[model samples]
Target chain A: MLARTSLRELRHRPLRTALALTGVAVATAMLVDMLMLGGGIQRSFEELLRSRGYELRLSPRGTLPFDTEATISGYAELRDALASVPEVAGVAPVLAYSISVETTDSPDEPQTSLRALALGIDPREQGLLRLLEGELPGSGEVLLDRRTIEETPLSVGDTVDLRVAGGLDVAARSGRARVSGIAEFVFSAREDRPIALPLEDLQSFSEMGDVVSFAMVRLTDGSEPDRVRADITARIDRVEVTTLTGIVTEANERLSYFRQLALILGSVSLVVTALLVGTIMAVSISERLGTIAALRAIGIPRMRILRALTAESLALCALAGLAGLGLGVVVAGVLEDILSDFPGLPQAVDFFVMRPSTLLLAYLLLLLVGAGAGLVPAWRATGLEVASLLHAEEP
Target chain B: MSPAGPARDTRGVIVVATDVTRDYRMSGSIVRALRGVSLSIPEGDFLAITGPSGSGKSTLLHLLGGVDVPTAGNVRFLDRDLGSMSVEARASLRLREVGLVFQRFHLLPMLTALENVELPLAAVGLGPGERRARAEERLVRVDLGDRLDHRPGELSGGQRQRVAIARALANDPAIVLADEPTGELDRSTSRSVLDLFRRLNDDGTTIVVATHDLELAEGARRRLEVVDGRVEA
Candidate 1:
């Protein structure tokens, strides 16, 4: 009887049913994409941080504020002294610089700001280099950010002209370095891009000599990073020392606002979906008032009528949820390709990974929406006056 | 024709109505649809309630069928008071013991002829195969064996009404309460439906029909005409 009633209600007004389905699908798809985007960002951040083998990122006191810029220097004598700390495993001196490159595809494109950090270290730490191709660049070679590929036309074995910040003369360095690789860095609390190279070569070419911008440290096993950072900060008065935990915390604090905004938008979409479903179900119940009365008159119990209607609502929601899930995956995939051109986004993040727990939660929410929409109508149908409704006279 | 056994008189009265009255709450006023109607129907009896429009015959049928409760008096079916039963229990009883046919032949629109007959059985705890077989048998009995898969919208008025009858008889109930079963049919179709009711009565399936058509009412074994909610001599 429920199957019969549901089918009849759905068929009676095909257009309305289709509209309800589409509304639910749209809402569910949006919800899924929102959740996927959040998860992808978190994953990309975590993976990027873990790849560098730096358990903690320490920065100067009040030096790197959110949406602001700051830098610290590593005096050669201080670097040697930091390596003498008991928990210090190794200190890789880093020279950081910012520059912009104009791609052949769009020459007038605003010089997109990039964080080019030169690492003065042995070329043996392959774990530190998250490469998408060939190999890590030698001293003379430079590796671009992984996100730069989609935005620029520079390919393997191509010479890139780089214009340093505050330098009027564009450095047209002609050298064919193997595409060597592309890599990701920890997402910043502000707009920051990552580019890597052999540390000493960058200093000599850019005329910024002997000044190490920062030092990335790998701690020994079982060494508490905060204790190490505190010890280092107390001893070093000339430059600031920031821990990796501090860096991650600051980054998350900034991303949390965007995540909350996404959540609010997703919730609003779901509420609209609920209203649409409720309206459609109400009309369906009203239109089928006569049929409900007929069933009741035939000695069919009121509860069965309620069950039948509830089942119908659930089936509708399930069907729409499944369709929406599929659509959401496709939409996210397409968006991923489009977002590739924008380096501000986390690179190569798969935004359509549907987790079972997420799908389960979504299904439950949709079921609740379906049941809630059907409640009033089910109650009204059960309470109908059988004699009045079933009488032969058309009133 | 009685079954060849000692008439199971110990089963008690199958349906008993004592001073049952039904009233409608109209626009700011209560209109009495039935007034102090009392009747009892034993098993295997065929009774007809006849009245004009607004005469309350349908009200009486509803009370007797347990589709409704009287506003004043009580209706007891098989020794259980209809008014006392919980809503769920009443529905269970309807599924188990009572079959209803209406003037409009209220077949579920989406169901085929056979499936429409099978609908009432769905709420029962019967297996799917048994439900299907029973529905098929009932449809075949109603002379719709060939139209098993034809939906109600595809069937004629007579065919649709036959499907309703098949649905009513699907549960093999104790009583079949039909409210103007032929009210929407042509003269020939009405006679054919009345003939079907007569045959069902002959088989000792208790039948109570509410109607205004004289020809339909006159053919019943027992007749009670209702006027202003009271039985007329």
Candidate 2:
């Protein structure tokens, strides 16, 4: 029924209806993008933290991962103590530092010495990077990042010299390692050139005995993260035990600027939608005032007329809002691409994530704008004086 | 072809307006459109309220049709006070009982002639098939059976008014209040529409036409002349 009368009225003015649809589509698209971005970063961070099933992180006191150069001194005893906790499944101690190395086994090309960020981990218990081609680094082997291989002419099965960087005596903590594989570093930013090796190798290379930057603790299934975290905090010292939830909360606080931006722009989009729909409907109803007044004279109820007008606006918004969702996905993809280039963010992290809730919220807001935009004009149109209008006299 | 006669209801009086005065506020002063006018329309009566433009003839008809409220008096339809009815109830009353026609014919320009006639039937909760059937019947009665698919822009002035008249009779109302049934038609077209109204009145459908044309007013069985918002002697 609404299709026949309400939609017909909208179809009567094709140019005006098309323009209204375009305006609403653009506004809703912006709104959807904002809705996605408002939570995308935080959600992606939480997913990254829980990706490897490690529910807790042990970082140096008052520092996030890779945030500072501070390390946990005497980490071997702490790692053993953490492994003894009842809820602990396994623990992987990781150390991060810089190393300067040149190819030792590749005799075809001239040796090019380059500095790279290095991670030393218990290879069997690590949850950080995925192997792309070859095996994890063993006793005398190293996993090179793709970027490091791109800079140096070394591939898997080649050997390179490794020396701990930024110390007074460079030769004291130096060793040679065979390239075992290429790896996908989960937290590698665009600027990072990284290499991974065993914990003892790096500890020996850096000459920092029994030291590491952090430890990732995997909890047994169904174990309460807070209980384990509390137990670890009580039993461990000189380290902070952070749960996945806490890391995500802290990330949200840090991403407050983006969230505020989303709120402002999302609100602007809604206002634009309402004003565009309202102005178009008001003008359309003004043009059709005579027809509306005649409809009233012929006994069409005000509620029915109002409903028809609202249906017209809703139809416009529904069609355009659907289009907006598709357009927003494309727009969000492009924006995520551009925003991910921000320095220090991991390559695997997304800035604009679309979920079911975002789509539903955007759709619901469109309907609200539709209803609000049509109400005032419809009320006025139905409230016209029938007798004066029919007589072609001003009321 | 013969037209349907007036509904066979035996009620005596259909509408009554007592000492009705309608005023308008224009440029800060009151313009009294109708001043202390009183009248009663009986069932099946062919009445015309004739006066020149701005003489309040249309205003009187509007009050009688329940489209406008009187500023100073009461309007009663079927022994029920119209002024006290809810706005929706009054609109329902007009939809189900009083058929209003305008000088311009006021046919929805966007609708085909049949769709225009179906508007009131749809308002009355008729199904699509039922609304179409009844709308076709009303248009055929007004000698517009062949013009059902034509829009008002495609029809002649007389045809449009015929469509308006058909719409007015769509629900088989007790009385139709036409403000100016043929004001926009040529003399011959006006007579054609007038003849259709006379045919309905002859078959006993009550009608009230407000017009400035004396010839059109003379065709009515009962004439009430309004001048300067009062009934003339």
Candidate 3:
């Protein structure tokens, strides 16, 4: 009955209740979003890193894999030596270079040329490219990402001429290859048109002898990554062996801005939620102080009255938090779409990932904020002088 | 003066105030409201404490009702010291033993007449069905049975006062302490409320009324007049 009464009192003034709920709901939604963003980038990066089952990466010494333009020499020797180590399932080397590809147009039109990023890798053993629409490209053919097909006139069956671009060999090393298939390049940004061809074709054409950017190591099933990394590191000189965990940690450090933003914004939203809830409760209790004193005079226990007040605040914050959770998921989707479009990001990484821990943390914070906000007014309401307030009605 | 104490017959006395003095510190100055004023209320007695405004009639009533402790001296409800009781225990005492009515009819505007009457009954932990029936019966006793569902804001002055009186009687207390029960009513309504008090006393309920209205005071079986916080009974 007391709860019923408390609920009725909140409903007694509908506009005030609605306004309070709106403010609290907005704050709650923001906090929920912040919670999702706090460690979401790191979590999703780790997921992407593990998706291919490539447990270790060998990058140029003092660099992340393919993080820079530095290349490793004698890729075939390095690959063979790493494959001989115990628990090493296979090793695939990768190299990236830019090329100007010109397509034959109609006789009435000039040739169309565009600069495209191309990868050099063994067709059978690489972890980076996945066949989405067509078969993997052979030596004389190249694979293009879906975006390149959509954004450019290139498709799976077009023969295009290529020359080394964006470095010392602007048009120096020239060749031609057919577009054999369209594939998914996991590291390509949304706007990047990338291609993949045989490692020897790219190495000989670009005139960078047996050179590759990095190598990815896929361990045998049930092999520990740390043990494999130690063996590979000892076996391969002039190469830095990076486990998936290490890369994720290093990327997370670089992305600390996201977590810091989440913490600051989440803290601000919590403070706002606390203030909105606290002010609403204080005003509601203030409006009913006379009735509270009268109830106290009529033998209603102070604890009971305070409990009713607490119920109001608890319900307000909890309901608002729930509503905000639903709203936050939608907002996070929109924000994620916007962020994933950022240039140079891994295609498989999500900007805002939702986890059960974030949801639980958000809700728990709201409950605590509600309890804290409600306590002040409840104490004030119960502390009023019953005799003075009650007997003010005497004359 | 004989120290202004109640009679020695403990069995007949339900409340006794021995030289009770109540003081208020207003704006950093002590203003005495009751100066060693003592009184006793016997079982089934309809006693009126009458005084003009600021003469401490309400203060005395507050002390007697166990709502406030005296500054100097003591008040006992059924031989238990009110000043010594815990706040919760004192509230429990009020719930099971004392009923209080106010002049302004301090009914929660959000509650209907029946709920207003049911407040004290609910305080005593009465079940829903029983408290509702009891509240209806109390409202009928005050002639406001038809207005049970009307909120206090929707009711007239007389009806609101009747609801308050019904609320005071809901717990079936041993004593009903009315602080100016008829003070806000018109002549006819005051007569009716005073008649209700007389009927309650006749039905063997102890009644205490603090009021300035002479007609209401004179209607009580015994009257104590106060001037400058001293009783001139």
Could you say which candidate leads in TM-score?
A: 2
Q: How close is each model in CA RMSD to the real structure? A: 5.4, 3.1, 4.3
* Weakest lDDT window of 10 consecutive positions for candidate 2 chain A: A164-173
Cα error of candidate 3 at position A55, Å? 1.3
lDDT of 2 by residue, B199-220 (tens): 9999879999998767788989
Runs of candidate 3 exceeding 4 Å displacement? A106-112, A166-171, A391-395, B1-10
Candidate 3 CAPRI grade: medium
- Residues A57-160 of candidate 1 have per-residue lDDT tens digits of 43445564222234454456766777778898877665555555443334555434334443433345323446676566776666766556656666666555
**What is each predicted model's overall lDDT from 0 to 1?**
0.72, 0.86, 0.84
Write down the DockQ of candidate 2: 0.59
Q: How many residue pairs clash in each candidate?
A: 8, 0, 0
How close is candidate 2 at the interface, in terms of C-alpha RMSD after superposing the true interface residues? 2.2
Per-candidate interface C-alpha RMSD?
A: 1.9, 2.2, 1.6
lDDT of 3 by residue, B1-233 (tens): 11112223348888999999999888899999999888888999999898888999888988998888899999989888999988887887887778888887778887789988887777677788988999999999988878889999898888888888888888777789998888788999898888988888898889999988899989999999999999987
TM-score of chain B of 2: 0.94
Clashes of 3: 0
| Clashing pairs for predicted structure model 1, backbone only | A56-A243, A56-A244, A57-A242, A57-A243, A57-A244, A58-A242, A58-A243, A59-A242
Residue-level lDDT tens digits of model 2 in A1-395: 43366788788889988888888998999999999998788888788878878889998888876777899998879978987898999998899988887777544788788878889999899988989989999988999988787777888998889865444655545688999999989888877878899999888878778899998999898999999999998888678889888888988999988899999999999999989988988998887777777778877888888888898888989988998898999999999888888899888788998998899999999889878888878888788777667666422
In model 2, the Cα lDDT at residue B193 comes to 80
Model 1: DockQ vs. true structure = 0.56
